[model samples]
Target chain A: MPVTNRQIRLARRPVGPVRQEDWTLTEEPVTGPADGWFLGRTRYLSLDPAMRGWLDDRPSYLPPVGLGEVMRAGSILEVVESAHPDFRVGEFVSGSFGVQEYALSDGRGTRRIDPAAAPLPTHLGALGTPGMTAYFGLLEVGALNEGETVAVSGAAGAVGSLVGQIAKLKGCRVIGIAGGPAKCAWLTEELGFDAAVDYQTEDVRKALRTHAPDGIDVYFDNVGGTVLDAALTRLAVHARVVICGAISQYNNEHTVQGPANYLSLLVRRARMQGFVVFDYVTRYPEAAREIAGWIADGRLSTREHLVKGGVDAFPETFQMLFRGANTGKLILDLT
Target chain B: MPVTNRQIRLARRPVGPVRQEDWTLTEEPVTGPADGWFLGRTRYLSLDPAMRGWLDDRPSYLPPVGLGEVMRAGSILEVVESAHPDFRVGEFVSGSFGVQEYALSDGRGTRRIDPAAAPLPTHLGALGTPGMTAYFGLLEVGALNEGETVAVSGAAGAVGSLVGQIAKLKGCRVIGIAGGPAKCAWLTEELGFDAAVDYQTEDVRKALRTHAPDGIDVYFDNVGGTVLDAALTRLAVHARVVICGAISQYNNEHTVQGPANYLSLLVRRARMQGFVVFDYVTRYPEAAREIAGWIADGRLSTREHLVKGGVDAFPETFQMLFRGANTGKLILDLT
Candidate 1:
């Protein structure tokens, strides 16, 4: 129980953009497990934009990461030693293991992840929280119907890409909205979305009009400022808007711009609902089975944008999500 | 055949409040019918707050009554002569008939109403558009489940009363929001609502918190603006808010007070859906049958605030609704 561990801790709460000074790298000897505890070694870390929200001292789905604590993160780890009979030493597990090289777990809310069925990173992406998010957000909250039209903003990202593809799999005509030509190309040509509207150059409202001539039935909103406004104007009757994450407004120096044309909901008889994926923890297995089936049948695809550097690289790896630096699922390999 | 006919026409558009000057009384002679036309006499003229929306030059569920034309009104009339095969003499027909003593109909969209089941005013209120609206708004749009709590604004009015009673019949705990103590008393004492909040004197938010301690599951919003904001704060998880009417904001000289606490939908993962009851015209009969069954079993109570007046009293009868003058269904008996 004298294993040395290195960790990235929150030096200060970030203002605007996260800086290097916002983090403190420190080392400590990993402590031994108590009666109910199990020891684990970090194998991979899940870099998510929601981590940014967790840093701010405001009300959110989860509490903010305290200063001088190991930065909160979802991680893949191998149980190296165990006093808890349920967790074996060779088993792969996932939980809020934080940005650390090694950790001791009491197995409060840990789940075993199978490395043989899919890659370890898939547990963080297509088979994990982000994947379950896209699944529940689109299908349940969005009330997505087969053959309906779906439009997704930030379409090339981890959740958005899967959202578009899931809509397509549901027999919906899917339109992807992303920043650049590469992302748009990947959304439509590679991911099999019905259309991709490059929001960088094109007028999103006009593009929506062209792609969904009838109107958008489901809008999976990731980038929320003006893009959310644009989608508000094009909602069809009984449309369901999934307010997943507002990435565009996250870095705002001012207050977030809510939609000016919300009256459209009154006219269209539509609905907008927000969802945090963790709320569906009990239903995750149900969604995972459906998603895994799609992945296995060649109806779905999984992509991981991996960045290697272990726990020390947490700061820069976390920044990449906000800058749109990584595509598909952004995972940090501890190896 | 020729007969003297009297009609109320839209003479001018109202600036703030509608007056007698806005309408013109005219007497005309009903001539012989064409091949498809039949003689009809106006038995009951519907005096509704929505008449105000119909007077304005804007698009709504129904088009505006054009200047110099007969003011549009839903009427229960008796077919005195038959030209169309589906039509027969002495049969009461409900249609978008103008405010007139007598007229000829081509019978495009008319429904036969039996006076034996209930009176003509009951047909216009409890078994007509208002009843149909309450049924579909609660059952279809609200997706109201049994044991869920339903809070309705303008709870003493036609649609709101029906909404509360229907929710009760569906095993929902119903709370009514009305303007006065009398209406609130009637809602609770007679209409079978669990509680009624008098918004005229009491703090609505505090009242909602007291009555619905667990939070509101369905908000059938007949009165928008401040009432809606109050209800928004009390929404439970997955709550469905039905945007029926905004009578409180209908006559406002300025813009309606759009809810600022709408982000509660995001916070609770609830939904707000707006629908005009006209959208469910196809299922009006289905709504009528269920509502009638509830009435027959004494599970639902029907109340009409009938203003005894002829066609000359149309403007005043209409004005009463905006002032919240009448409880239950406000109708004009043009007998």
Candidate 2:
């Protein structure tokens, strides 16, 4: 175990987009695990769009990260010392271990992860929160069916990429909307998405018409803005819109521009629903096992944009999430 | 049969709140029904919030009313002359007969109504489109469960009133939000709604906090806008918000301000779904039977704001719906 621990703490709440000055890195002497507790060092830190919402002091699925506290994040941790009966030394586990070198846990919400199953960072990426989010948000909340057209915004990002892949696995036509040509090409070429619309280049509304000629049956929305509004107008009867995340609106200091075409829900007799992956805790093992099978069978692709640095890299890396700077899962390697 | 048929036709689409000048009254010579068609005289017309949406030249569940075309409406009609096999003289039927003294139907989308079962206006009110909207909207779209809390906006209006009543009958605690003290009182005292919030007089958010301490499980929203936003904030985990109508935004020539607190769907893992009652046509008889049973058992009450006038009064009476000047179902009786 390290003699000292480095931690990133929230210094202030962000306005509009997050900045480096909002976080503070500090060092403290490491302490041994107490009774019913385990000490683990964070290996891979997971950065997500939802992290922005957690920075604001508001009521969400999870509580906001308080100022002067270790910035909250999901990470892969290796148990260094253990006083808890269920956790032991050298075991890899994942949980909300925060953006720090070491985490002290009573094993309340941590789940053991196997390095042999996939890479350590893969657990923070495809096999971790992003993977689980894609799994449940598409299958459970979206209720996707075979041969249906599934369109997703932020198509090259962590949740959106995996959502398209899984929808394809379920025998559905997948269309992705991304910011640039390179990301759009990556989605259609490498990830096997049926088609990709580069929002930065093409008119999304017109592209959606050309691609999804039969209208979208299920839309996995990760970025909410005008893209969502365009998709709204093209919904088939009984379309199920999974409100996974709205990265576009997360950084907005102003009010969220809710889809002006929301009445399309009435016109098309459709549903738009939101969910938190944590709500499916009991079913996680089942989903994780299936997703693992897909990965092992080479049906699912896992990618991580790894940033090599200590705790200080968190703020800059987190900014990449909202700016659409990083594709696939963005991670910070603390080791 | 009348020698001449008086009708109201759309003059031009209104930019905002409909004006009297937007409609033109005309008279046409009454003709005998052609082969396979029946002639009918209108009795009561069902004035609905959806009428405003139909007036606008936009794509919706149904097509918009075209300029110079007889204004489309649902009404109770007495078969004055019959050339169709199934039609008999004086039989009452309901269909899209438009705002005219006489209609010609081929029995395609028409359903016969028995005046002996309830008053003729009741069929246009508690047993017609409004009642059906409340039934499927609450029971199916909202997926309301016994003992859950249901909050509805436009509490004194046709659909909202019936939604609260049906929710209460299904063993749920019901809270209503409406304009004016009398309308709120009608919901709580007359309709058996557990609580009522007068949106015009009280702080709706604060009232919702006090009434639905556990949070609203099913919110049947008819009048959207700020009230919908307030309800969005007070949702419980897995709450269902049925988006039946947004009368508040129907007249806006500008953009619709969607719920600012819609992210609460993500926070509480809730759902917001919109539906058209026409989509539930296969099960209308099933719903109508149950709702009529409630009325027979004295568990339901019926109210109609009756307006007596010729076709020229159509424009002014239609305005009553948007102005909230009429309680319950607003019907123009042409008898």
Candidate 3:
């Protein structure tokens, strides 16, 4: 008997916050792998804030997911069957496998990951795109220096959590801004962040002044809007503002609220730059090796909020990011 | 008989646009220069848009003009008497003389200017702060390359006119955005700007698309607001946005309007930076010599709207900058 493959596809472009009706879950019969092709059974799907940008039909760094097409996603999968020379059966691999139970690939962007080295979901979090985004966004784009004060928004999220740790490892003072006391405590106590601001209960600008008294030298902005505005006000002279992501404004039905205090860049003689992590793909191996070393020494910690559900759970699982409900990397475990 | 110094003093901080009540015209008997001081009779007072910023009680690159104090201004003056060793009587000089008929200086931050080298008004227009702003802003901050496309707002103003002309000299395609058909025509026909967008009549974003089809490589922003938003959208990959001034937002009683499409920086892998001309004070002579060479060879042209009025006319003359009534440098000639 042929296997049944369950998949989630985009039904329509989302107006604001993604609704369940915007996606359709369907199942199809799977066939055996053809020549030069390998069949993979999806194990975990990476749910990212950036994924929200992919659903819109606007021109961006990457093309938007087409209506009625399988929702684009990054996933770690087990190669159950293969006719390809490189990929063998029963080996775990990571690639853009979409929101599906089974996928066929010729191994273009696919990379083999050792489950012994790190957990399968870890490949979708700290060792994956989130890791890459945090690494390059802080070290390269933010141009962080030792002894400098670094501030990162979305402090409890995957990218922001890693950013604070990396900045700390580089001998810098780190301040993390998150939604609540629990998430903020997790950053300062568990992740070893120098300070954490509970943006929900505290005034961000006042908190930043108290925490980073000398002003922030590097601000890795993951959440743009009023947080970005508060960060702008506290910039040290010649500070660098790295535009990693703007998760705060991603699902806006109207226009994105810009940083009204951006003129602070002028008064401070600073710079605000933006970049895509894929632009540094060729250097990913170099960064990954360094990050893995830190993790091995127990200096760097990794966390993931794993939701045990099939591909059909993508919509609800994905909404956790915007709601700030997840502590770290949010992943759907489809095992 | 002692000279009576006519002066304009700040009466109160302005809320929105500057009103007549914000200033007080007064006269005081000027005393002879003391040891290490020089006395100067103000000739031409520079009316700049940046002056608006100094009137507000906010922390900026420069301190706000204090109430009951002489209005801070840049001016051309004739040294009438000198007790300082370096400055001599009967010579012309330029310095911060304020909006007054006579000023006393300690010779610090003062530069002697030969009337034969350039006209007295030209010293304030192109060889002064405005010229320094355009040179460093376009070449250093903007990091302009040959054959690249450059777009400048306030294209007919003191700094914008020079930026467009300099880019043209560097083998780049230049587009100027200014209000009114006359200013737009002057930019293209006289200043050699490749194209001109009449922002008053045309949609700035649509006009930029038509003029800069390949997108702008360097956007020298002088007038921020919607114009900055328009320029932000039309930036090329790796474009540089030099934030020199935001004249449009200077008079706002409320908050400034930020570039709503600022995320384009990420999509295009671009950067937006701000700088103060005073930061490059040491290199001013080197840039001045190069710009003077361009002027001598007819490659650069300087224009000044000379208003022949005494120091009392300063309040009305300064308002012309906000109204966009001046074609080039607006100078109140008190000679």
Candidate 4:
């Protein structure tokens, strides 16, 4: 362990697209764990679209990261020292440990993760928050069933990629809407999606008509804005729209453009619900067990784009998420 | 019966606020009932906000009325002749009998309505589509519970007035938002709402803060422009928004302005749903019985604005709904 811990802190609330100036990379002396607490070194950091929401000074599922505080994030950390009874040295754990070299947890939200069960980075992808979000958002919030026609926006990204695979595993006719032909190819060819809409080259509304000839039964919406509006226009009766994240509107300098065609909900007797993964914390183990089984059975696949960098790489790596630069799970390898 | 039946037909689809030119009143020779059909004398016509959506040549739960077709509407009628086995002469029936003096029904959507149970016009208000919309939209879609804080937009209008009352009846704290002082007064004083917000006089956000300090648990949205956006901002965690209608955007010459702060759904883990009352047709009797009982016990009160004129009055009376000119259920008394 180093004598000093490098940390990224929020300098100010971002108005629109995040800039390097919005964050301050600072170094502090590493401290020992207090009673009932444990210290861990962050090995890998999960870069998520939801991180953008936390940068805004607004009321959300979680409070905004306070100015000058360590930027809130989720990561896989290896416990180095512990004064707590439950935690031991060399055990890997996952929690909202923020962007820093050293993380201190009193075991409040921390859970021990195993490297042998799956790769350590996989815990941050399919077996982690992204996986759980896809699980509950589709099966619980979305009420998706077998043979239902599902359309997923941002289908090449972390949560969306997992969502499509899981929906496919559940026997759904999956149509993925993603930018670029390469990402679209991966969704249909590799992920077993029934069809793929290349939102970059094709008209999404017309493509949806061609692909999902029957109206969409479940729409896992990750990208809101025009894509969401187009999906709204093609909902089947009693459609369930899972509002997981709105990556498309997260960096807007102006007001978030809402779906103008939302009245279609009335026409179709449909519902749109938003959910946070933390609410299903108690059931995470159950979902992970099932998802791991699928992975072992060769029915599910997750890809991670690991960028080798120090703490300063956080800003640029996060920007890749909005620009569609990363194909799958975008992670910062801090080690 | 009359030798000539006076009828109002659609001339053209209105681009904005409906004009008289969009309608053409015509006279047709009266004809006797055909086999499996009934001839009825139209008594009361229910004018609704949904009438505007029907004017648009778009796909909805029901098909749009073709140009030159008699304006489609729901009304109470006295069956004068019946070749159908189910419907008998002198029976009061409720169905989608168009805007005409006499109507011929194949007894498809028609149901016998008892005058002894409730007054005839009440059938079009509390026991009608508006009441079913309020009941199911609040309880089922909004998932409202006792002691929950409910904020209803257009609270003095047909569906909204009933929504506020039903929420109160179910032991909720109800806050109503309406355009004028008179309607606001009726919401609080006469309708037994805990509080009222006059959208015309005060800032809606401030009023919502004052009335629903804990935040609105359920928002029964009727008017869907800025009012819907305001309600979206003030929702409590896990709040439910029932989208019954959007009278505010019905006459817009442009696109319907969706709730700009809809991302609040994700922030609060909330839900917004839209439903048409006709979907609950099979359960109508069960809901009507309960609502009627509440009316008899003085737990529910309804006010009707009756306009007496020929079928030519249909266009102006329909416009009154959009103008918020009527306090409660707006009806056309063609008798």
Candidate 5:
């Protein structure tokens, strides 16, 4: 008897906001794994803003997902069968498993996970790429100092949330910029951020003037566009602007809106730097250990917005990230 | 006998390109030097792109040149009368002496220069602020390394020309982006630039691809507009962009056009940093000594476009920078 597999594949590249017509759901018969390979059942899929960049055919850090191929994604999966030496049946692992019910892996980037250590979704949120992004983006790239003021955009998102918390732990005053009142409140009250600015309602430049009167020492930017321009206007002398991501401009049909106040770098003698997390892959274990300790000590928290309905729900659930509907990590529960 | 001082004073702030109407020529009786002051005759005035930034009533590294005030300028002057202990009569000095035939100085920012070492205008050109800007901007801020590829915009101008020469002296492959055939020819033929892109006729991005091949290790941006955008796209891994000046956008009546392809910084893991030459004033002697030695040994060369007529010609001569009319170190020979 053969098993059936359901998968969402890229149909066409999206122009602005991704639509359902951009993807095609297909059913195929699952094949057994070959030697040095393993078969896994997808349990959860991580939907990130960076996924949007991969959909464009333009040159980037990684290649674009080809049409008719399974949409690339990070996921937590359970090993159902294996012919490989390391992976065993009934063991859970994390890797780029794509948007499918079942996947075959050669164990290239796969890592075994202890499900009892933390929630399965936690492996995708805090202890995953988002966590690593925050750790390196703030501490290493930002070079955050004690008592210095830090401002982070997309403060309620997975990476930004962790960034603010980590800044707090390092004795820095952290200010967060988010889209709504609820998210702003969560950042200030729940995450221990010093202050939160509601970018949806308030003037960001004025808010920054009020919150960080001395100007931002380190600006960890996830959202770009107008908010980025505003932050540029309030940089302190020798400030560091960490360009981790620019989710705000990811879906623009035209070109990205360049920061108009970029000349502020001259007046302020500041630096704007960009980095990719995968470049620091060799040190992931050390970063992950530190993050896990913080999580265990109750010094850090993780939030996951789980949407159920398998791989077919992927297109709709992925839109939530751009719409700011999800407060934290947006994930699809395929279990 | 009293000296009649003819001065060019700021009459109004400029909206776009500066006009004769923006300045007022006035003659005043110059009094004897005070107890700690010295009286000096202006010899040559440096016409810089940064002067345009001073005319705007906005926040910057320095205050705006106030209306009715003598226009600030870096000039080579000869002391005629002195009451100060440090400065002596007939000594040539370099300082911010304003656009005037005679200037009264307390010697706060003034430094004595030996006219026998090089030409008088060389002190206001290659051994002055422009020289210091190139030295620090490339070596320290850009962090340029040997055998690297370097691209510099406004490559025929004072700072840009020196920037390319310094990069060449460091054993780097230097490419210069300048306007017109004459400036481009001079950059490669006389200045030893490996390649010269005539931005007026050539496609800068394609030219960069042909010249650099791999990518530019350092992009020293002096003209920030379409040229800056082109350079941003060709950055190598860990590239440094030194924002020294923006001559192209300095005269715009509206907002500056930001670099549309700034996201390349992220894709290439690059950085853009801005700095002021005044910040490195304490180390100017060290940099000047190195530059002077390079000039003495024929490793580095400098060109000065000296315009005749006294202080009254400042308004028209300054316009040459915006028009890209001068090749290197535009100066008003007010001798």
Candidate 6:
């Protein structure tokens, strides 16, 4: 019997803000696994700002999603049919299976995720690529030490939420920068950030002054541009600014926004570094274990803003992340 | 008997370059030493660009050279008379003895500069502030590992010249950046620099690309702005950029030209830090010993661009440094 499922394919490349016309929904006939392949039914599709970067035809750490190809995405799936010895029927797995209802994988770079360990969506979030990005970026790259102050932009979002939490777990005084009162409340009140800066209402520089009076030691930057400029002014001696994402600049039609006032690095004797999560693929299990422990100990909490939708709703759901419409990790559940 | 002689005093504050109009030479009625004081006759005075910074009414690492103050300069003197317990008459002494014919000291912070062991100006150049700045800036801050590529701008100047020779002494592949071809040639041919880029004629970034094809491991920055930006582009993985000074930015009438492209730090996971040599004052003797030893042996050489003029010529002497007219250590010998 032929296996078939609905898939979201890239219809056209986007210019600025990605629209529904950019994506095309279609049904694809999935071939049965030949030998070491397993059939995957897409359960939860992760909506990340990095998806916008994949739409543009540029040389990034990852290749752009080609036109007429299935739009790339990280998904958690239940194995329905298995010809692979590693993956069995009824086992849950996670992989870059694209925005689809069903997928067939050769099991290379795919992990069998546990549902009982945490919610299936949490595996796509706190235990997923976002968690690893935060872990390695903060500990390895930022070299965050105990008693240091950590100030993270996009503090209410997926990766940044975890970054602030993990920094706090490392005994750092964590400050969160987000859009609205709700996100700030979620960060400081729920996620355990020491301080929260509402980028809309409060001046970031003034907020940083009020919170980190001694200046920030580690800055986990997610939303770049103006927010980055504000953060640069408040860096202490030997501070580290980690460039995780620039969601604000991703949609700009003119130019990719780079920081203007980086001379502060020279004056403050500090450093700024950028990283991609894929660089730490070999160390993911070690990172995931620590994040899981934080969650279990009530030190780190996983917040998933689940948006129920079919594969056709991928374009609109992904827009929610850009508009700051979704809090925590935005996940699309295809039932 | 009165220890009376001529002295130069700061007449007015300079707006841009320290001109001849900024100084006034007059006869000062000097007095003999009291109970704990020693009277010394000035022999050789060290003229430095740091004098220019002192003339400005700003809080730098040290206090500004004040109006009506005997224009501050480091001097080597012969003790004509002594009442201080530790210092004896006819002994050689070194201290911040202003631009004057005679100075009285309490021997609190004065050290004996050996004229028999080496030339008196060597105490100001290779064994002075420039030498100390270069030694600590490269080893402790630049973290100069063996066999690493080191790129230093202003390589013919006091600090830069010493940095290249020391990096070479430490088994590093050193590149010197200077203003003229003659200076550049001297750097590679005599000073033992691996390569030299004349910034006046050569494209700094392109030259760096050709010379340091393996990419620069450590950048000892003295001239900031464009040279720093050029070095920033050529950084290898885990590079360290040491910001010693920005001679280009110091005299800027308008906005100090900063580096436009600094995002490369993110790609390479590099670090750039600025430091003042004064902070490392306690370690000065330690650096002095190592650098003095390097000069004592054939491992290092000293160069002095000496101007034969009275104390009244101090302001014009300082202006030459900003114009890049002098090579090696710029000093004025007071007769």
Which candidate comes out best when scored by lDDT?
A: 3
User: For residues A166-246, could you state the per-residue lDDT of candidate 1 as single tens digits?
Assistant: 988888999999988999999989999999998889999999999999999999988877788889788898888888888
lDDT of 2 by residue, A1-335 (tens): 44888899999999988888888999998999999999998898999889889889888888899999998889989999999999989999999988899989999889899999999988987888888899999999999899999999999998899999999999999999999988999999999999999998898889999999999999999988889989999999999998988888988888887887888888898998999998888888898899999999999999899899988778887888777899889999877
For residues B1-335, what per-residue lDDT tens digits would candidate 2 score against the true structure?
44999999999999889999999999999999999999999999888888999988777888899999999999999999999999999999998999999999999899899888789999987889999999999999999899999999998999999999999899999999999999988888889999999999899999999999999999999988999999998999999999999999999999887777777888899988999999889898998899889888999999999999887899999999888999999999999
What lDDT tens digits, residue by residue, belong to model 3 across residues A169-262? 9999999999988998899889999999988889999999999998999999999999999999999999999998899999999998888888
Model 1: per-residue Cα lDDT at residue B103? 71
Predicted structure 6, TM vs. truth: 0.84
Error of 6 at B276 (Å): 3.1
TM-score of every candidate: 0.83, 0.97, 0.99, 0.97, 0.99, 0.84
Model 6, runs deviating above 4 Å: A1-28, A47-73, A97-104, A223-226, A245-269, A273-280, A308-326, B1-81, B89-111, B253-258
Give the 10-residue window scoring lowest on summed lDDT in candidate 3 chain B. B110-119
Question: Which stretches of model 2 miss by more than 4 angstroms?
Answer: A84-88
Clashing pairs in 3: none
Which pairs clash (backbone N, Cα, C closer than 3 Å) in model 5? Answer: none
Tens digit of lDDT per residue, candidate 4, span B17-92?
A: 9999999999999999989999999999999988889989989988999999999999999999999999899999
Q: Compared to the true structure, candidate 4 yields what TM-score?
A: 0.97
Q: Which regions of candidate 5 fall more than 4 Å away from where they truly are?
A: none
DockQ of 4: 0.84
> Considering summed lDDT, which 10 consecutive residues are worst modelled in model 2 chain B?
B255-264
i-RMS for every candidate? 3.0, 1.0, 0.7, 0.7, 0.8, 3.4
For all candidates listed, what's the TM-score of chain B alone?
A: 0.96, 0.99, 0.99, 0.98, 0.99, 0.94
The i-RMS of candidate 3 is 0.7
Which of candidates 1 and 2 reaches a greater lDDT? Answer: 2
Better of 1 and 6 by DockQ: 6
